[model samples]
Target: MAAEPNETAQVNEIQKEYTRIDKDWLSLHYKISIGMVLFALAVECIMGLILVNTDMLNTTVPKFVFKFILVPSGVNGLCAVIDHMVVKSEKISQTAKIYTVSIINTVICFSLFTAHSAFTVTYYVFVTAIILTTVYASYLVTLSTSVSGLALLVISELFITWDVDKPTIFQSTLRLGNFLIALFIMFSVSMICMVVIHYEKRKNRASIRIEEERITLTKRLKMDELTGIYNRKALHDAMRDLEDCNPQDNYIFGITDIDKFKNINDSWGHQTGDKCLIAFAQLLKSNCIKANVYRYGGDEFCIIFHHTDINEAYETAVLIQDQLKKVEFKEYPELQMTASFGLAQYGSGMNAARLFMSADQALYQAKITRDAIRIHEKEI
Candidate 1:
């Protein structure tokens, strides 16, 4: 089924907000990638210094320094630069950003492994890299990066013999078996991360749906069931808004009533009276663009004009009264109707109650005249 118009609008707003948040997250991820690379560079330089001080290298000083220190640092810097370029590209998709970042992290980890190939602990750096990819919460990125890093590890193990002695076939098989076990554990970690991400996304969607329903319900409660305009409850809310109005701002209140509306209900029936009320509401809605129209009760309707002078509000009411006279009901063509209006303007220190009572008094005068307009001049 198609969504309601309001629901469609809400969805569009949500999509726009999500796009903004996604961009911010991507930028943060890029900065984190840069920090990680810098951290890797620092670790490499420190380890190289420690190894040099211990005189642990089997090779010459220059060879050890060049292979362990310079090469690893260069790889870190190069990966950081590549990540910078990818994040700066406006046309790149968010998925592409995640893919690039995950690959760069793996490469940095691999370079560190290359420098310390003899150390069994350094081999586990690949596992750490795979686990870090889970930070993006992307299943595809984690899976693909894990598989690629495992493949590189297998290839490196084949040619790069860590020990001085040539391993027998059984020893080689045992090493390969250990690699297989590590691969299984890495895949399991990736699966768990994906499941947690899925659960979080589902929970967020449910919360959003509940919030939308609440907003829709609030709107329904504020609206008149028959005329679909603001109801009496909404008018009370509007009155509360008066306290926040600026002192320089002009506010006009108008109370309008259909003259002898009871006669229409008595002569024609309540259904025709309802139709007349709906038509009057439409007239108010179409004519008073800058005002809020409310169904006060029965045939009495209220209008609160924002930032409008009393004269302007009075003129609008007159125009509505004239137009209401011309409205022809299809069910009862011979019937004619006219409405009375009472207007009052808010003054300094005047509260919403005072303004409404002033308008109501004027409405009483207009009702006595029947099919006329009146204004209450008292501001206090």
Candidate 2:
């Protein structure tokens, strides 16, 4: 099934974050691999010294050099080359990079197993590599690496002879059976890790859904349902924001009212009056691109202009009044409308309330003339 656009967007955001996390993990893995190689070299050197001193060495000295020294070094060198290629190349897919890391880890662990075949404890390296793959939080990578590790363990059992004490065929069979039990345990751990990762991703998706809903609800609360402009609540919020803003920034506030709006309701009914209000709000929204328009109350509107010229604001008010006069109400073609507007510019040290009061005062003067525009004069 196709995802909804919003859901798709959310998923994209989550994937991007995971990509960043994977990149960091890749870097850490590279650094740790270098350290592990150094440690492995040190252990092999010590083991060689102990075999020589204790006279427990079974293989020729040159064969021992090839097996213990050269083989491990070649494997480590190959890993370094692959790591550099995968990490630096931009063309490699993200899935490929993750798989490369898992493969490298498996190969390194297998190398350790082959180097110390006599030590049954080295078999646990496969299990360790499987567990480390879980940090990527990818079920596919974890499962694939687990299967690969199991395969390598079985191959080592069949082909490679461990230099343990001479034992009967029955004892070797019993040891192989024990290793099979260990494989079962490794597979179980991988399943558990996959389940945990699946649940974590589900939880993250739920969180994203809840946050999206909250933002949608907030927008609805701030919007006017009737006319689709901002509501009085939004205007109040804007006023508070203006109060908190730098006092030196210039602002202009305008309050407007449809002239004789109550008479329109009385003569043509409230429904017709609603139509007029909606049309007026639409005009303001479409024309007043520089300002935020709000439905302050019944038949009244408010605008806040940031850093606008008083003359420009006054001219915009006139244009709105002219535009309103030209609108033909199809329901009542005989009906004509005009709006009165009052504008006030911000002054230093003036609070939002004071600035609002000044615009309201100008609105009162405009109302006296009816269908007029008035600019509040700053007090000397």
Candidate 3:
């Protein structure tokens, strides 16, 4: 058999909640990525300044060369700030920013090669740093599958540069071996980081799916199959929480029961009686503006209005009765049903059990006195 209308509504609500949580997680992740990139740029700038002041290079060459190398690091920082301000899911904009930074770094490396006649050990180190930083940052910003290809190109360039025979301290076999070992280590670390990131993304997606399923199951358990409202158990749990919180403002609890419901069931079939209950539940839900509606057992409904005054609660109850009079039960065109409501407001002496009993007593009075609604008034 197909699920009832109430069950479908509950499922929809749970799905909405899960979607909201997932979006929040993604926003937080993007913010953290932006922060990390900014920090990395700051460290790179400090290292660049230190290199210009040290005895590593002759003053005759000028310090602007070091400054030129740091330009791409500055660009990375600017891109990170721009990415942080944009809305989430702008993947095309993010990809463009990352590619622009990568191209700038490549240009800087080529410029450095042209500036020097021969590739010294320090120059090779600087070029390798630029290539590794470009590849890693591109991978972070894009999560593209072609990052490994770019890394291989970098490694190939390093090997080709080392093959040139020149009178330099970097031409020894021991230095060549060290350079190869360092390249291998960097490649291995980058591959490992990529694997970990991919695994985490998969794990997070699975966890989100599982959480959605659990929320669906919990909704089914707490909701009434017939009335599309909280079951009696759920109602009690909510009342307990309200009682524990017990704010300074007043709260109202109202109980409503269908009048002469058994007579309608006896005259018509039980299916028609079920239809009447469903129609009445929808009426209650429509009338509940700031209150929570609950299915408080068969033929009985409850409403809890938090942070509401007694006068407002009474006015709301009268409005609900007025609306119910206009409902024409389509399934049973000739049939009509009326409801009796009893309301009580919370005060210093009120507890959940006592408040419920007070509403029940007022409801009994409404049924006996032929009144549509009754409010319990304690004598001053």
Off by over 4 Å in 3: 1-195, 378-380
Model 1 per-residue lDDT tens digits across residues 1-380: 01114534765677577667756766776677678667767876787678778866566778767776777778878988998899888888877887887777777777776666555566677776666655455668778888778776766666564334435224777655666776677677667767876775776588678778877788889889999998999888888877677746888889998999999999999999999999999999889877889999998899988888878887888889889999998879987888988888877888889989999999888888788889996421
Worst 10 residues of 1 by lDDT: 1-10
Which of 2 and 3 is the better model by lDDT? 2
In candidate 3, which residue pairs clash? none
Of models 2 and 3, which has the larger TM-score?
A: 2
How high a TM-score does candidate 3 get?
A: 0.61
Model 3, range 206-244, lDDT digits (tens) per residue?
A: 766676687778777888999787788878877777777
Ranking by TM-score: 1, 2, 3
TM-score of each: 0.77, 0.74, 0.61
User: Where does model 2 exceed 4 Å of error?
Assistant: 1-35, 77-103, 133-135, 140-171, 247-251, 288-290, 306-329, 370-373, 378-380
Task: Report the C-alpha displacement of residue 118, candidate 1, in angstroms.
Answer: 4.6
- Arranged by lDDT with the best first, the candidates are 2, 1, 3
Per-model clash counts, in order, read 0, 0, 0
Residue 288 of candidate 2: its Cα lDDT?
82
